[model samples]
Structure formats: C-alpha cells, structure tokens
Target: MSNIRGFRIQHDSLTEKQRIFIDDFSKRYTEKTKKSKNYISSNRYHLCDWMNSLGFKLSLKEMLYPIISHSSEGAYFTDIDGNRYIDIAMGYGVCFHGHKPKFVYDAIKERLERGFELGPQTVESGEAAYLIHHLTGVDRVTFCGTGSEAVMFALRIARGFTRKKKIVIFANSFHGTFDGVLGKMAEDITIPVSPGTTEGMVEDLVVLEYGSDAALDYIRKNADGLAAVMAEPVQTRNPSLRPVEFLKEIRKLADEKGFLLIFDETVTGFRVHYGGIQKLFDIKADIVIYGKALGGGMPIAAVCGRDDVMKIVDGGYYSFGDETYPDPYVIFFAGTYYKHPLSIVATLASLKEIKRNGNHLQEYTNNLTSILVEKLNNLFKQKSVPIVVHSFSSFFRFITVDPYPFVSDPIELEILFLLMILKGVYTWERRICYLSTQHTIQDVEDIVKIVDESIDEMRSGGFSFTF
Candidate 1:
C-alpha cells in the first residue's frame, strides 16, 4: 500500500476472508435472482465478452452483471426479469423530477405533436433561454447538447474574454471529460496526474489543492495570468467535501484581480435549489454552466453569464448586407441541434414546475437526506464499521472514516454496490446516491432499512476495514 498524502493506494489482492464472503454472496444472489441473471447473461453478452476480446478488461462487469432495465417511473425502475429496484442514482442526478414526470412528458408530447426537430431556431428555444436567465439572473444564455459541451464553451468564453492562457482548477473537481480540464494533480507537486494529456495542454493548466491555504496563495500570485477558476461547489463523487470558504475567497479574488469565477453546476443546479449553489450560498459567479436536471432528462445544457462575456458567440448578420460584420476573433459555438424543440419544451416545463413548487421539493429532499445520513451513521456505529455517510442537499455518499476520504477502492465499493442492489437499492460505484421529488418519507425509511441490513450482513461476513 502506498499512502500519498493520506490517500491510500492499495495494491494488495483481496484477502481470503473477502474472497470467501464475495463468493458466498454471489452464490446466494444468483440463486435468489435467477431470472435476472439469466436475462443478463443472454442479452448483455457484449459488455464483458466483446470488451475482453478487444483486450480491454471490464472490471465492473467482473463484479456484477449489468441490471438490464425495462422501465422506470417515479423513483423506481424495473428490470426486464420482473425485479424492481429503488433508483437512488437517478440517472446520475439527471432525473430530478424522477422518471417520466407528467409535466416534462406533457410538454415533450405537445412538442412531438408539432415537431421534434426544426431549424436552428424556435420560439420555445427563446422561451427556455429567457427562463434560464430569469431563474439564474444571468444576462445571456447559450444552449448546447450536453454538459461537456457547455463546459467547453464556458472555458472558451473565459479565455476569449480575459485574453489569458492558463486556467486554475482544484484537485478532485470534475468539470467534464474535456481534454483540456481532465488533468489531476498529485500532492508531491512533482508527479503529474495527466501525463497522457496532449502536448501544450499541461502548460495551460494550474492544479491547486482543494480548499488549502497554499491554493489561495497560488491564486493570489497567479490571478493575472489565469482566465478563470473553475470548480464544483459540491463535488459529485465526494459529496462530503465542500469548500465553502474557499469558494467565497475565490469570488473575492476574481473580483479583485479581474479574473472570471466559473461554477460548473452541472450536478448541483436545480437539485440543490431553484437557482443553484450560487443562490444556496448567496455568492455569484461570472460564468455558470448548467445541465442534467435543466432539460429534465433530455440531452440539453446551457452556458450563462454576463452579457459582455457571453457576446463572444454572437455572429452578426454579414451575408445579408448588415452594417456590422461578424468579428473574426469571436469564439465560434454552434451545433446542428443546439436547441431542439423537445429539449426546449422540456426545460421550460421543468422550470415552470420548479418555480411553482421548488421550495417544497427542496425541503422534502433535504430533510430526507439528513435523516438518511443520521441513520446510516448510527448503523455504522452499531456495527463497529469504519465507514460514514455524508450528504450535501440531495446528494450523499459513503466514505471511509479517516478524516474524510472518498472510497477509492474498486473492490470494496463494488461489493457494497452489489449488496445494495441485492437489497433493492441502486447507487453509483462512487457510493454516491441522489434523492428525487418522487421519493416519499416511507421510501426514505425503506432505503435506510435496506442499508442497515446490508451493513449487518457485511459484518456477519467478516467484512471489516481499518482506517
């Protein structure tokens, strides 16, 4: 095991006790869910077999077969084999109003009657943009197909407006899979986390320790060369780690030094509150990126910011003999389906619903999350397990008890995921779970009960970890 600044990189193979427990649990699960196993084996053969044939090992499949989903409604989904599971993952925080929500569906159905895809512009698109501007208080809004594209555009706008070459990002903060921002930094300062990063990519990135005084010092020193400081207020993978003070400080520095502060609220947008983390914290950002829940499960995302910074995408009419020609240096941002009718209608409907009932939904989910964390911690204490549950708003995760470390071990987290699935609860491998408006108080209680039972079973199987 190599401990890198409190992060344990465990390379040792699974212990004998762990192997025995896993084998026993697998056998029991297979016997109990025979139909599901058969369906998965017959239909989902390509995920593992095909990948292995291509010389790529699929580790997640080795642990558990993919649960072939048949249908989803509210906060639950049913597998093809007639098994139902409570969906706490919620499409990785996309289904805020839950699956097949009536408001979103009705809006989409209406648009479907008119048309699914039109030209580059639509009345609904303008309405959606106006709603986003109204809700976020941003002066302008631009649409894209996905969250990754939105982040990419936001970065381009930042660099274009500030005329700076470098961007500062915090360690463990996930903006997107974009090549420019995917680099990770090690604590040693010598080792690079993104050696495969394309040439010229490393030179433009500055990785800082999340919420450290040293990071603040670095920002103060290099703010002139930085185009923006991009971050997620609450990291999706590690929900326990929130740097509130650091964010406030970043805003102050951005204001003082004339650099942009960008908040990637892709996961925390409407789910945290009606506005976002900005509204929750009462701290504004120069640029904001929103996705996931904005489209109510449709493939849509938006980049909103001050008017001066957002005008980089404006291409004035030149071919039509307008007086103002388009600026050659302006950043180009467009897509074939930039604002599809379905996405726009869904977004508008989602916003209307949220505006009407956002407070009640936020309160319900927040209260449920609080109750869940308390109950899970109590269970962990009772079982003498070195695990803890932490939550921020509707997002929660299970972390090891060692001054707040994310569960980084694949095998350990996979085992827990399988156990939860066996007990009719689903979550991501990061041990992160989400709550939706579709979930009731009874549903929260059931989730807690299942988690408690799963931990007790693990204890009986001799599953223990030392911090």
Candidate 2:
C-alpha cells in the first residue's frame, strides 16, 4: 500500500484487507449480473449500515445501481449495474477538473510511499497554498478538511479581528453543515444534521435573503456586535438568479460598518473563473472561504484574507485565551487534517489541470449552455412542458413556476427526473445540474432528447403541463 507509484500496483499485489475490498468488489459485480440485487448495499450519508439495521429511514428512494463504490480516482460516485455513468455531481463540484484525473491519482499514489501526515507541513502543502494564493490574490491561508471547518475558521478570524460577535449568512446558500450555519439554513436545521453538532451550539448566526437590498439596510441599523457578512457571489444550487448590485452594496456596507465580508466560494471558486467570483465582478471581500471547486475533489479547505486581519489569529490572544469569556472572540480554529499531504497533493494537481485548460473549459461550458438551452427549450415546448432550463456556465436548474397542459411542475420534475435516470443522467434531488468536464455536447443532446420524450409520455398520461 505504501510503495505505490514509487513502486507499482500491477507487480504489487494487494494485502489481505485491500484484497478483501477487491474480493467484495468482485462479489458485488456478480450480484450486479443478477437483476435481483438489493436496492442499496451502501449509502453516501451513512457509511455504516448501522442506520438502516437499527431502523432509521432512507432520505432518498433510489437505490445503488451498478453501485461502483469508491470515493476517489478522479471522482467519488455510485455506479449502478455494469453501465458507467459520467458523474456530473463530481462530489458536488468537488471534482472541478474531472473524475480522478490521472495527475491527481498519480500524485496521491506517489505520496503513499512518501509517508502520510506527519503532524507538520510538507512541500505539497506549500505548493497547494502557493497555487491558491496566486489565483485568489490572498496573502496567506489556513487549511482544514472540509468547507464547514473553513467557515468556522473564518468566523473565528472575524470575531478575533473585529472584537465582535454574530455572523451574517445568506439564505439558500450552502457553506456546510455546522451550528454556526444551521441557525439559518434553507434545509432542515432544527434537528442535528450530524451527530456532533449540538442543538444550541450557535443560534445567534443570522441568515438574510440574498436578493434583497433591505438586508444591507437592516445591517446599517443593526451592525452593532456583528463580526462578518459571509455570502456566495453567486448561488451554486440556483445559478439562474444573480444578486446583481445587492452583493456590491453588501461589501460597501461591511466596509462602512467595520464588519468583515467573507465570501464562501466552496461551490463557485476555481470552476467559475480561475481567479474566483471576485475576479469576475471586480469586487473583493475581507475573508474568503474556499473548499469544493478549489480542492479538486480532495478533503481540504482554506480560509484566506488580508494579512492584517488574519494576523489576529494570534494563538493565546484569541483562541486559547486567559480572558475567558467563551467569547466567540476567543474561539480558536484548528483541525487534525489541516493541510493533510494527500489532500494538498490532490488540490495541487487539480489546480494545475485547471490553469492549463482554463480557457477551453470556459468555452466548453459556454457552448454547453447554448446547446442545452436551444435543444431543451424546443423539446419542452413541443411537449407543452413549461419547464425553463435556467443555466450559467456548467451549472443549471430547470424549473417552471407555471404548469403546462398535461405537463410537469417542480413536483412533476421528479417524474421528469426518472426519465433522466433511465437515460443514464443523474441530478441532485434538489433538481439542479452540476456539470463537469466529462460531459460532452452529446451528453447535452441526449439529456434534451430524454427530457422531451419523458414530458411527452407524462403529458400523454393526462399530466397537466405548467408552461
């Protein structure tokens, strides 16, 4: 296992445990050969079967298909039966380059022999940090294992730097599942999403509607004790809607009121444009939280910002302080997997891939948008399906507020979604498309065709169309 790329995989046979993983893989393959396989042998949310075995309910009905089990190699996805589906989710924009690009896989393989995390820095960490700082125009970075951790750190930095409390987040934008975030989440937040998050760890965080000017107005009168205003430049799950002047005004207000402005670019970072969301709009924030697209599908995250503000992360002064207020001001941020070598190596490889092919990828996304809209609109019209394909770059969400004659609404998009499943296309349960480099013009065409046919079939069955 250790001597991988430095040695080899073909000549190096697997150990008992890994051999078991492969053997179990073989058995699963055989079960796939039979049509009578159980729905899901494993799930993404709960790695262990303990939940189902102990009587918890399943969130989604779709079971694993060819069930290609793996977290990395260019992508982390579940493959149904024998047929391979190009994963557009790419770990939900984590795989910005593609599923397990060769460079990333090779980097991880090489690092295996170099030994893993040593509770210290490695050359790869510097390399990854250099890549991020160069692209984002930030002076320094602190690494962690997930987007939520990065956000958590950003809050600490904000409070420590400003000597204040309270974080301002946006409604409908996702940072990660954390207490600081759950207080104002679009998703269910009353119950703990994860085990460790307690109910009242952070109920003071505020969530404001993103497309509102009143938010800034409210902040003006209510800026006291506020530490940071964190937001996404563009909402990833719903890219069709842009905040326009509202975001710029937020930055202005944050500056005027002395609250740090943090942009959580977890979903829209490296992929939107190499320089990130700020580069596209000519606006800058006080602190930025980057994870998803930046890490290239690795388990790494970063909190980046101005040196003076970040310098407030002085250990004894803020995080581990004698002042003793549990003052969120004293909240120190640290993580075990901060700058893990494997993750850093993956991020470095992924960043290189993005820089090398930035223009081509942008063109690909632009062309894809054109093709999908042109073709899909016609199909939906012919079928009397009122669904509108709202797109931006490689991200899109097809939704219709109105109903069609014997057509599908948002609820009906679910049935329309099944057509996608049969056609070998997968979408988030939220009904948005997270595109990837693996998708081609043909994939777009195929999706349009399937959508048209599915809507027609549903309409024929007396379903009313919304458009």
Q: Where does model 2 exceed 4 Å of error?
A: 1-80, 185-202, 314-331, 404-410, 460-462
lDDT of 2 by residue, 126-171 (tens): 7787877888788777788888888878888898788888777776
Against the true structure, whose lDDT is highest? 1
Tens digit per residue, CA lDDT, model 1, 212-306: 89999999998889999998888876677778888999999999998999999999988888888888888899999999989898889999988
Report how far off residue 440 is in candidate 1 (Å): 1.1
Going through the candidates in the order shown, the clash numbers are 0, 24
lDDT of 1: 0.78
Q: How much does candidate 2 score in TM-score?
A: 0.78
lDDT per model vs. reference: 0.78, 0.66
C-alpha TM-score for every candidate = 0.88, 0.78
Winner by TM-score: 1
